[model samples]
Target chain A: MPYSVVGIGTSWGGLAAMRKLLSDLPADFSLPVVVVQHRGKDSDQLLTELLQDATDLTVCEVEDKDPLMPGRVHVAPANYHILIEAGHLSLTIEEPVRFSRPSIDVMLSSAADTYGKGAIGVVLTGANEDGARGLADIVKLGGRALVQDPRTAEIPIMPDAAVKAVPSAEVLPLEALAPRLVALSHEREKAGARRAV
Target chain B: MAVPVAAVPSTGAEPDRQSFKPDLERIEIELLLEGIFRHYGFDFRAYAYASIRRRLWKRIEEEGLSSVSALQERVLHDPEMMEKLLLDLSINVTSMFRDPGFYQTFREHVVPLLRTYPFIRLWHAGCSTGEEVYSMAILLREEGLYDRSRIYATDINEVVLQRAKAGIFPLERMQEYTDNYMRAGGKRSFSEYYTAKYGGALFDQSLTKNVVFSQHNLVTDRSFSEFNVILCRNVLIYFDKTLQSKVHGLFYDSLAMFGVLGLGSKETLRFMAHEECYQQIAPPEKIFRKVR
Candidate 1:
């Protein structure tokens, strides 16, 4: 199946990491990328704007029931837990999990549940263990689990936890992620075409 | 609404001690919600399951329970635990002048409609600690409509209602709210609305002179009165499709002809049964006017 969705979770040094990741993706990258970056409850739209400036793709903050469209980057708003349902996103005000709203685990697990084998979950540099279990869920559901190589990460706790949770996950240097995602998307597209024929 | 459960196998080498079953958990959650509703009369049975599950787990961890079934036991036997779970289940994420565009558009478009009314009744459903309610009061005051407007702010939880009635917010948020106020087309300094003291910015009490704060559950309560405008932003995102439709019906019944309905920027009246009954007043902001 074509990789239907990409869910990214990052924190600590996420602003720079996300800037680089989003900057690397081409303008026509054919997958919806949903990001959950941990930040203060009071954090403003400056982060979304900053990331948008670095990327060629359209980046928007996720709203309740916002449709998931390919070639767009959706970032979870600072204070809401973003749930991935079929073809759309939902926001909740449930109390923070592990002291964080827009929790990585919540987003990744929901994506895994919604997209199953068609989801791609990436856990990048962060200071917490939030995404580990969620990434494991993605892998369990037969989806790709990508982790930023801990050695190269600014804050390796998150990626390391992800790798530890799902040892089979591909751990790559930050520079390799965009290309790998592109290649995977192409592979999925070709497979989809073959299925169609 | 039933969320699709992915059958994810354990890929690890270790033998599974207890097989994880998503269906079992769903059953437990359903039972828990049913029990709570029957015993305590808080209807969360129709809430979106994923978020509800997360909140229940939070309560489970806090209460030292092992699973959802255990948490249900505690909830059924203990009122305090139910209160904690009630607070958890009710989503309260809010900010002053959230989605400044909504307020800005309301000021530009809906204010004119209200200007035509000699007396206005506005209902703010699920007002949640009153951030948006206060924001509306401020906006109406600036538009010279506060005196003629009676705002009814209601939430399911009484705890949040008390906090909303206080009208005191964190002083730290004042700077951020001021930015939003200015962005939403404030005519005067945002700081003029509240005085900072005791580590809080206590808003001018006179702004709420025509405002009423009460406990009203949208899932169960009947429409108390007709309204010229109803603002229920960011609240319906927690409900399933069934409840959303039902609430839309309630809003439709409550609104007078040409009255406005403002939802969070993320919400829409599309896919709703009442979609054709209202016309989109502001496209970017989810403000609609009932035309039929």
Candidate 2:
């Protein structure tokens, strides 16, 4: 798991908000992005294609055993959770946690468990507080956390929820999220490479 | 699949959120869920609020709204938005023979009891997209019970129902699922169950010969048919205590005397209403047989 996971949690106007972060990152971005957004099991997921068109990165709906790769973004495939184990995605049809299958917490926590310090957990906009505990899990596992600016988010409860749990997360606006993710990715890469060396 | 009855915790302690304060925001969340249930007839009010909070928080920032109140307003006015939120709200992640060992135990222990009955009915409650139902069908077929059993697979979300009917998964995944299928004691080549094309594996339609896919909500819908075996793995964890009890009672009523029940690894019959009612047949697999 050289350049591993960047877990993003968002809701509300998340499609547009996420595009802001994805478009800024080059297609060659060397980390896999897995996102969990609160959505209906029936809603059309154009985000994979939309993000593909919006950004230079490879975008695709995640499959049951989709291997994690750098420069690729895996959207939790509508209602399925995107989880990582032994460096592979394992989706389950388990009951919704925090009312979502692609639960932000499940994905973040799994990423922390799988990648540990190599992971970056990012919380974006939403009306509820789903990712708070997830962000905490990431931090506890030694992964860095970044929360979207509550004032700038489409919905602020999400960021506020996360902040309440862990006040030290780097809270930034949607505009600055990609830079922060990229910087975190670069630093994690060096650490990972050094460990390998 | 019929989730095995967890040992009903005698206390059925209020959903373990004591450490985390449930502020006015929490109450508002309850209200929002209640509103959704009342207006749309999808009963999410009794679902684990922790799961709801997790998903909604992300939507809040992405939607650029400040509160659940604002989110509530939009959800009420916009059917499409509400639909989107519903997709986000209901957990739909599932696969065939997920946790193969559990299915292995079902084949070894539960299938034997089912043999005594001339005909068997198995319900996969909260079936999501029907993967487990097909998994059951495959298992029953191998055990020589497919022709005698009628499997009803139900879920609240229809979107996943269509996908479940299609039975197409990434060909890339069949390797593992096939391995799981074999490890679970498949009688034939796992590939014998499906055809591979376009980088996807299309499972056999015949395996669904006895499976009836339908829509039923675990929260709002009542148990309609009596079943010989119920596999409700991983669904009840999303429910709050009261709702879990309601569901457990439904399962208790739905099951035939000495019927079999299967649940997820993390879920159990401990401290549930039916804790003493169903004796554990296999603890590791969470398989229970009704004793009373």
Candidate 3:
């Protein structure tokens, strides 16, 4: 099946990385995108606004039960774990995983389980090893896993971990990621269009 | 502009592979939650597994235990350990007027209906630490409804309930709370509501004169009375789908006709059995009114 959603995880240097990647998403990006960027407990709506300024896509801070819709970018709120259900998003105050509430692993694994082969997990720039296991889960579930080429990353630790964890993951540079995802999303939309016919 | 950094070759230390056995960890977690429920009656078995496992491991690591079973053994026998674990499980993050927009909507839309009632009973369920309950109290007072309203703020943990009753918050947070209050449409200077004392800001006692702080576990306890409004924000997210539906049913049963039901900013009634029974009073605020 064509992927229905994209799950991205990053920390540390994620803000700039996200800005570059999200800015590249076309306004009609077909798949819903969910992001878990580790942030401080008191971080305000500044991140969402910043990402919004970068992308044509509607950037929103994920609220509980927010619908998974195409063309919208949902960013997990700080200090809460965002779980992806079948067609909606849920937030949890349950303890942070690996000292990170918006743990990349939690979001990736949940998205992997929820979307299975129709999920794409992307591991971007970060300092910690949070998204590696989640990317592994995505790969194990027959989903695509992508990692930013560690050498190209502002913070390489995160993508490096992901690369080691999921050998099959496409390790591409940051600039190459947006085009790759855009192509994947376009393929899925074509598949969806074909199904409709 | 976002800085474009060149990609470096993968040269970091090898990833920290998961050391524990997944099947074993699952068994141990199930056993621990079951043990905790059987021995202490604090049921966490219905909580979502992934998060619960993370929390259990956190407690285990904190206690320097090697496994969930080991943590379970100590918690079952040690009251202090049990208390600590209880804090881990029940302690939720909340703030006064946390989502000012919700409070703003409440003041504008829900207040008029509350004004119509001769006497009002508001239930603040899972009111962890009571910042939100106090916010509601202040709002009621501003609307001139405090004189005839009684706010029952309950939580699963007594530790937070006591803290809520004291009405003392850290001095540093006052600035944030003041901003939230103003955004929520406060009628007067936010500083007028509290005085700094003992390095904390002590809210006016009169604000809570009609407020009752108590311990009530939503998981196992029955609703005590029908309420005009039941505000249980940010608490249900910790529960599994089964428990969330169960609690929603309880709220539905406990609400009087046309009563208000306010949830956390991120929560919704879309998936609940009683979803159609209520009307969304405030869009995107999670405020619903029982219409059936």
Candidate 4:
């Protein structure tokens, strides 16, 4: 399947894991990656700067109605829920679900709703189980679901819960996720080329 | 712009033919919005489509209706359903001193400018539930400018306006609000401003002595007055680009020279028609001074 977007959810130990995954991806990555990393309400743009340093892909904090483009990494801003729409993102200051403002579930579920089979959900290391249900939603919507192997995670609880929710999800070690995504992108490109012919 | 409708899993039917379901749903939503504007005069037609679509679907699900057209049938015929949908649409998720950093920056930057004027006029556009309005009042009081400040707090929904006028907030939220107040540089105990009554935090009435609460639709209403500062944080995110530009024009016309315009943290004046007219006063905060 040709994946259009990637929705990644993580909390505790997310920054280092994100850095590792993002740094390993090629500069010409073919999908827009939306990330929801649990952070303090007043966290600054330092996350964006740090993530940008790790990858050649352009990374920035999402604003309301910001467009989604290939090779861009859009980080959910602090103190808001990020919802996915067709070709764009929307931010809301609604009550935080499960004590998280930029709730991983909200982003991933919206991705599932908008992108359907084109959505890819990735659940990574975190202290909480926020991404479990969202990954389930993605799978239910005929989308792909991936979970970082709990044994390889810094904090395994999140990935473990995700595995429990979607047992059929592709479980990969942290080191292997970037390569898998790159391989998926190449497959998507080949699919697009086939359609063109 | 074509608002892509979310794809529903196709049943044992022609998958390509089922693609038109989203288009039909989109048309239903547009017709519903248009019907609402013509019949009720609430111009939500230009709201950010995705957010509005989510809200409409929420209302639909809550009402146990099957589709947008079904919800529209009820809303048009029944004023009560329309009222409920209005609440859902205009209910902004707001809190006292939301993004406390913005208030801290206001104290450091905007307060000094307000000191120059003998009397200050402030406008809290889309002041849902009045938390930010009262927060501003307390901030002004702490800064010794509350006596000189006149605030006009307005919203598109009258129900929220009434709630704002009451000055009662959930007592359970006080702990959170208190934390926000401290971070916003509160001078006194946050509890001193409110007393527990009616199972809620009934704030001191004096905090709103100069405040005028009214129903004013940002999408349709005209500018009422000039002001020293205008705050419409996180409110315009619901609007589409055209509506955002139009409301920005309204704010531009309403502000006096050098008046400050404060937006939500994520919002920016970039790409705005009046972008070059104002200078950003704070480095990262969305506070701007109308230079032109």
Question: Judged by TM-score, which candidate is best?
Answer: 4
For each candidate, the DockQ is: 0.24, 0.05, 0.14, 0.29
Better of 2 and 3 by TM-score: 3
Q: RMSD per prediction, one decimal?
A: 5.7, 15.6, 8.0, 4.4
Ranking by lDDT, best first?
Answer: 4, 1, 3, 2
Candidate 3, position A126, lDDT: 91
User: Candidate 1 regions off by >4 Å?
Assistant: A1-5, A11-33, A37-62, A66-79, A86-88, A94-101, A112-120, A125-133, A136-144, A150-161, A164-168, A174-197, B1-19, B196-199
Looking at model 1, residue B69 earns an lDDT score of 97
lDDT of 4 by residue, B102-163 (tens): 99999999999999999999999999999999999999999999999999999988888888
Assess every candidate by TM-score: 0.80, 0.60, 0.77, 0.91
Which runs in model 2 stand beyond 4 Å of their true positions? A1-197, B1-22
Per-residue accuracy of model 3 over B210-233 as CA lDDT, tens digit each: 998888889899989999999998
Chain B superposition TM-score per model: 0.93, 0.89, 0.92, 0.93
> In candidate 2, what are the lDDT values of residues B80-128, reduced to their tens digit?
8788887787777677787777888888888888888899999888887
- lDDT value, residue A135 of candidate 4: 92
Write one digit per residue (lDDT tens) for candidate 1, span A8-41: 9999999999999999999988777899999976
Runs of candidate 4 exceeding 4 Å displacement: B1-20
Please report how far candidate 4 places residue A138 from its true position, in Å.
Answer: 3.1
Show the colliding residue pairs in model 4. none
Better of 2 and 3 by lDDT: 3
| Runs of candidate 3 exceeding 4 Å displacement | A1-6, A10-33, A37-74, A84-89, A94-121, A125-145, A150-170, A178-197, B1-21
lDDT of each: 0.85, 0.76, 0.84, 0.88
Please tell me which predicted candidate would have the highest lDDT against the true structure.
4
TM-score of 3: 0.77
Q: After superposition, how far is residue B44 of candidate 3 from its true place, in Å?
A: 1.1
lDDT over C-alpha atoms for residue B121 of model 3: 98
